[model samples]
Target: MASSPTELPIHRFNSFDGVELAYREMGEGRPLVLIHGYFSTAMVNWVRYGHAGKIADRGYRVIMPDLRGHGDSARPHDPAAYPHDALADDGFALIEHLGLTDYDLGGYSLGGRTAMRMLARGAKPGRAIVAGMGLDGILNTAGRGGYFRRVLTNLGSFERGTPEWLTEAFLKTVQGDPVALLNVLDTFADTPREAVEAIAMPVLIVAGKDDDDNGSAEALADLLPHGRHGVIPGNHMSAVTRPELGIAIAEFLSE
Candidate 1:
């Protein structure tokens, strides 16, 4: 049986910018940090999917944090402040605050992007996994820019223009200021190609076989300096939910 949320060990740390961040710690070996995507909270992204327990079973200490402006963390309403660099800084702050010097890191979707940003900034994790995201920073720049513009244009027409399913999903996952999502999307547009190429650590890039928006998992593998690729049998969201996928991640990180 999965551990109940109340049963998991949770911790809080203060960022350099004074934001209070909440994180969950599990297992008991080499430390590993798990970052969730945009809109999704750490509990939903990591815990709900059973990744937390699997990592724990591997004898790896897992640290899952709710990024600032998401979940239990402080949500600042200023969209201009939620840049990728800032997100990377937040990860560094959490790791440093926890006194972890050589841990592993993994992220899904938006969190995966943040992981890439951390690598860009010279974060030296023992190993890393960038799941459900690709390293096409230049290509993503154009795609995300167009996507955010369309979202912004539709926000005012929320009731009439947005699909019911999408609205429901957004409402369920987004716990922070609405603008924070847009801001992060905007910041994603400016991610440089050089940054993607600068990552020197061994990286595992996992993507869904059906994830069309970010190109093929093979393509992402080709871009990394030391990247290995794996394909899970599902779409973007399903890739995060599947237990087998998490096991694959645990095995790779262990090696």
Candidate 2:
């Protein structure tokens, strides 16, 4: 039986550098590692919106991780804790810890970017899903990374109704740590075009109809050898909260 949203158990393990990371699991079957977005956790991105339940109900063991510096994971203040592609390193560590040799991988926004990093670094998930991300997001992380840096650096100053203000509001809603999140920014790495082209696994590049926040998802899909683009209703933020996102993912993975 699939676990109810509220019944999901939180699991912990040490990351590569001894940093404690957190993850939640539901259902039982072929493993599917689901990574959450920046300033978000497994609960908010997956469980709260019923995504995990929906995916799990489709016969998958949904493994959702709280990326370091976010959620219940260890938030190390030491700058040394965050190296280049630290989140990807943590993902690799999670795979090793769980011994996931023949599973699927997916993520949203930062999570999506991290999934790409993992694939580029040689993770061999049978299939992959990259949601709420686009070609620009993968090829050049600094544009979005720097935008978030400004938001964190100038938290309360943004005027209402502005994008920055909206982001800060979400940050407050999630109770994010500005300092640790800032450090996590150091881990962002630009994926080479060759890296993107080299990913031979079937990849579903799904994004919100109105989400061009990172770039063109269609373009990204076109670039991949076995990529396909799907659009759900809503923008980047709103789309994640919709059932359409989960439905699209379940449908694609089923195919």
RMSD of each candidate?
A: 3.0, 1.0
Q: Candidate 1's residue-wise lDDT over 1-255, tens digit each?
A: 225655776578888778788988777899999999776888888888788788888889888999877788877777656664677888999988988897899898878878877877788997888888765533465664455456544655556544434644564455545665556564563456666667788888888888655556666667778889988878876778888778878999878
- Candidate 1 TM-score to native: 0.86
Can you give the lDDT of residue 124 in candidate 1?
Answer: 92
Per model, state how many residue pairs clash.
Answer: 0, 0
In candidate 1, which residue pairs clash? none
Local distance difference test, each candidate: 0.75, 0.94
Q: Which 10-residue window in model 2 sums to the lowest lDDT? A: 1-10
lDDT of 1 at 43: 86
> Model 2, residue 158: displacement in angstroms?
0.6
Error of 1 at 73 (Å): 0.6
lDDT of 2: 0.94
Over 111-132, each residue of candidate 2 has an lDDT whose tens digit, in order, gives: 9999999999999999999999
As a whole number from 0 to 100, the lDDT of residue 99 in candidate 2 is 92
Point out where model 1 deviates above 4 Å.
1-3, 137-139, 145-149, 152-168, 173-176, 186-191
Stretches > 4 Å off in candidate 2: 1-3
